[model samples]
Target: MKLSSFLQYLDALGLLDLIVKLKLRNSILLVIMCHEIGKNVYYEEGIPTKLFEAELRYLLKLRFTFLPLCEALEIIEEEPERPHRIAVLTFDDAYKGVYENALPIMLKHGMRGTIYPVAGFVERSVAHWAVQIGFILRNMKTPVKIKLESLDTSLYINDEYDKRIALKTLLNMLPRMDVDEINSVIQCLTQFLDRELLHEIQELHERTMMNKEQLKEMAELGFEIGGHGYWHVGLTNISRERVRQEIESSLNFVNAFMSSSVCKLRTFAYPYGLYDDNVIGVLKELGFHAAVTMKPIVNKANNLKLYEIGRLSPYRFGLMTLSSFKVQLMRVYT
Candidate 1:
């Protein structure tokens, strides 16, 4: 059985909760990585607001203490005599869904987490390139035929299956290219798809990212407004100097907007959960206190690496379920 199904089976037999009680101890921290937080049809990983609330409620019932990213790092670094069963929520890419949908729910539950915005996206009011791709795939007409000259591949989308395959193929190929080439591919797609790329961008802009005002409001509300890079490109794929520019520009934008109270602990989530020695070095040089990756392992406080912190995401688990979520949470104690 798949893990989620297995967890469901355990739930059916009344063993899941028992297992949770037995295994979920208060000894480690669980950092959750998320993106959009509403019914983002174009964004698959985007969790609906109701489901997010359910997950939060489930975590609370299991007695996990929600910690801000900064406080969680402090506890791990200090190695306190007693550690709370900690969970930190980190939203990547500053989707407006977070401010419009996720924040109210989080506020109602007395929880605070971290938000990472792409400085360029927020400033330009544009969706991430991935979101732009999603918009094209979802809105393009049937029987679509397009050529990706960058990848030397052509897509023929006649039905939903073909559309999905085309999307997966493009998504897989796009990240491997540098930002300039990716832009070229997008421009090519806009032309071949015969769609008004600018109009689609405008449509997605409101759904994709928060503006200056919303970001400021979240910062004032005590959220750790962190950086996801200036352009949301993979830092590891760029030149070291370009990486420095991205990090410095991102930090400058975040630092300028975040309150001193929130800026006291500067944290970052890698744009694609990617980094290397050079990336880490740049982060340290730029004074980032902690950085999180897409790794799905729970953090062991005693052996934590501040700059190389790991995080978990529901997207990797196939499906979102309370039972599956509980099993994922059990990683903290295991």
Candidate 2:
């Protein structure tokens, strides 16, 4: 999945739509070359995180399904001014591998995208207690003291760069603690790991979050359901009435059982997309309409913003050409 991704090198630089469908540009360069094949078969050096998580689930199953049938059968079958149509295949903590591998590659290329999902880790495998206390004190062998209130580290991380310096020194002190010091450091590292290493550290984050019947089959497939706040935490470190009680308690948990979903559910992708300026004025007084940021830049309906929304972090494909996939999508949007 490294067809030199800068958004698949800006969709293979639409060079006259790959010179008018050279077989849909060799079938999206062989779907970004088997989407990074077996990417070092489940992460060797974690093969650049399994080649940018298999080319962002092969560019969200090639943008919600065959980039609109390769633009209605081969790039712009009808282009009357919608040229800013750059791919926006998103998926933040909207995980469960976006309903297992971006919805079966968006059913298999009938394509459509958008998913923000952190509504507090959905039907719960509940993560982000500082990446489950830095993978349980980086595979604790013992000697773990972490006190806080002044700092008294007992630290005993034996190797692998002292387990990435004890998981970046408790993620720079778990965002300055206080959720009862992050539930007493996730109950003192789940009382020194076990429950089979906390279910293999929640299956080492293969990204999970989609449950109530697969978010009701991604809200019956039209797919615009948004929101990410309910506990992936960080509304500029809490309060403005806890960021409207974490975005109206995650829009009442994605509207507890749809109940006729989409009610002016303007968009949101902030949890870990991080926010500020009073968290974009509490996502425009809680009626969002548009918000996304991991800040790479491309969304354009009159350049909307509650926060400077721009994205495209999926990269690391390594081959399948046109100058190495536009040098990894110009290194994620240049």
In candidate 1, how many Å is residue 177 off? 2.2
- Each candidate: RMSD: 2.3, 17.1
- The lDDT of model 1 is 0.79
Candidate 2, residues 111-223, lDDT tens digits: the string is 55555566766645565465566567656665454444334564564556665676667666655443556676667656766566767766644543355567667666655
* Candidate 1 residue 72 C-alpha distance from true site, Å: 2.1
Could you tell me every candidate's TM-score relative to the true structure?
A: 0.91, 0.28
In model 1, the runs with Cα more than 4 Å from the true position are 1-6, 194-198, 332-334
In model 1, residue pairs whose N, Cα or C atoms come closer than 3 Å (at least 3 residues apart or on different chains), thus clashing, are none
Query: lDDT for every model?
Result: 0.79, 0.51
Count of backbone clashes, every candidate in sequence:
0, 14
Evaluated with lDDT, which candidate comes out highest? 1
State the weakest 10-residue window (summed lDDT) of model 1.
325-334
